[model samples]
Target: MSWLVDKDWWMKTYRGLIVKSMKLSFEMDQQATDLLSKMLDGRGNVIEFDEMKNLFKEYNESIVFGCGPSLLPDLDFLLESGNLRNKLLISADGATSVLINHDIIPHIVVTDLDGLIADIAWASLKGSVIVIHAHGDNIERIERFVPMFKGRLIGSTQVEPRPHVYNFGGFTDGDRGVFLSRTLGILRITLAGFDLNGEPYSCPGKLVPFNKRIKKKKLEVAKTLLKELVSKGVGFFNVRGEPYVL
Candidate 1:
């Protein structure tokens, strides 16, 4: 249900989409991937795939937090409703800092090494299992930060699977975290702060520097990939905005 299934899923479902549609550079992704493997093999404390799977058993349910506008409000609702007990908190990229700032250190964090490095580092030192995603844009960061990260490191990539880096059937950091959860055998996943359509009127843009249209396109891709995952008999419940639509 893990290694074999994951490899098949990556090839069958995601690889073509990444290469043909998204037009991602396979060469660059592989370069970043090889760097990750080198770090894992030589200088890093890379968590073996099986050992990483065992860590997911600490909680069967996980709430994946994105940097959408509803993120904080949803966390507040979960706290007020008293339904957050025993939930494995997984922060996607920048959400790690938000969660830590709120005094709730997530049990795991997923990132591409683009967020505030110091915040991610703090969470790592405090025992969060950091799921590091390697891709074209962050090869430098992979070399710079990986050696300094303190806890268990789970390596991820989209190009291909390796002894250390893995393909878990997701594209963006947020959905990639969800895919990782499901691939590791966790069936229940919740989404928070995921504004698929666009940023709300009251909220600043998620990635303000990028063109809004491009950001919207990326969000739609994430939503589509997540829906595809759900269509395959996985359970994903949205905690904010409209329920998931296929």
Candidate 2:
């Protein structure tokens, strides 16, 4: 248990392998394998596959975000900007409040319960779809969330043997949210606060130096995937005060 926290080499090697595996899976389109690796976190967990795909099918477009309080600066502008209309939003576990505080509600909220459990229940009760990423550890959160919410649960494929999470290289679930959004036929995707290589000082919070390395690597992955998506006719934009097509 102490090694999981205090050992730098352990994390670097394991997470590095996960990153390398993701590159391979993306090349091969073995998303199930990629997702399984992501879910494992080098600890342990088994992913349920059938349920995972079903969860992916429930949305048309997804706006994934970190909602790290810094996004509040652009929340209102984004909501009024009209680009996100009809898009399904998958707010990352703790970031849901960015939408709620600004009066912009999401279609669904996905989380592992690091924070803001009460807000998740509120969002769900208000008709927001909730997708809880279940693992061997968070059984309690999963059980609690399932009975309370009206939405589906997308079991992460990363929980299986050799687990991986394929987020199209956006770094975290927000980037994965965007990846999933594009894959589901959303022609245009605009990111808010998906500062891939940017220091997480404000809106999305700060990622430490080690995690930052992984993030940079993920951004490279996202660029390639987004390029492929564009070749397939998907468009991407970065939204601040206005949405800029990238």
Candidate 3:
């Protein structure tokens, strides 16, 4: 994904130490990447880079929905705005549930195969292209779910780019969606359901078992990277009344 930002720039922007802090290893990340590549061999379901560009070619804007406290309110605001007509809907991992409950299947869903297997699978079945992120923690999950998606998915990673896994310049799913939009040449990106500075990242309480402190740090890393993008002139917007200022 050297379209919007080059791989070298991404390498210089984010650090592998951050990924390592999450207990994700380079070997494991590569394992996941190679697994996805092997599974995709001779398959016709590839979600190619050109396909991504085409997916946003006619759209005037794209919206990334995060699994934050303000997600519902932001969704309501977006729905009330009456602007769902030409916007590409991208949802972060757990945010897929929110969109699905609203009867709105996102155009693309970014996930690490952490939780909500049923929801992610359901979304894929409903014509939503899934962008699966791989790392040390999700190799098993990737093995379990990649075959099931049958080509309706794209692979991503934070460590490095392999034949299958493309390193988009974001750590978390939400910001990664933003990176995807920017890389695909989407002009305007509105972020909903992002609570960047809200209440200390308590949302992932019981769903996924990970250290909260480390997770909070990852969120901060995401925020910093996003601010950098904003400073660099990427069109990013936060929903009204949300804690996030981007």
Top candidate on TM-score is 3
TM-score of each: 0.88, 0.57, 0.89
Descending-lDDT candidate ranking: 1, 3, 2
Off by over 4 Å in 2: 1-62, 68-70, 80-84, 134-151, 159-171, 201-233, 240-246
**Tens digit per residue, CA lDDT, model 3, 117-160:** 77878999898888888777776777787777743777787665
lDDT by residue for model 1 over 1-246, one digit each (tens)?
134345666666555665565666888998998888778875456677788767767788778888877888988887777667787788888888788887888888888887777888899989888889899878988888898797788788886767677777678788888887787677778887777766632222132254565566567668778887777777777664334553
Better of 1 and 3 by TM-score: 3
Model 2 lDDT per residue over 45-69, tens place: 2223333445456555455665543
True-structure RMSD, every candidate = 3.2, 9.6, 2.6
Output the worst ten-in-a-row residue range by lDDT, candidate 3: 199-208
Q: Residue 129: error of model 2 in Å?
A: 2.1
Please report the TM-score between candidate 2 and the true structure: 0.57
lDDT of 3 at 17: 38
Highest lDDT model number: 1
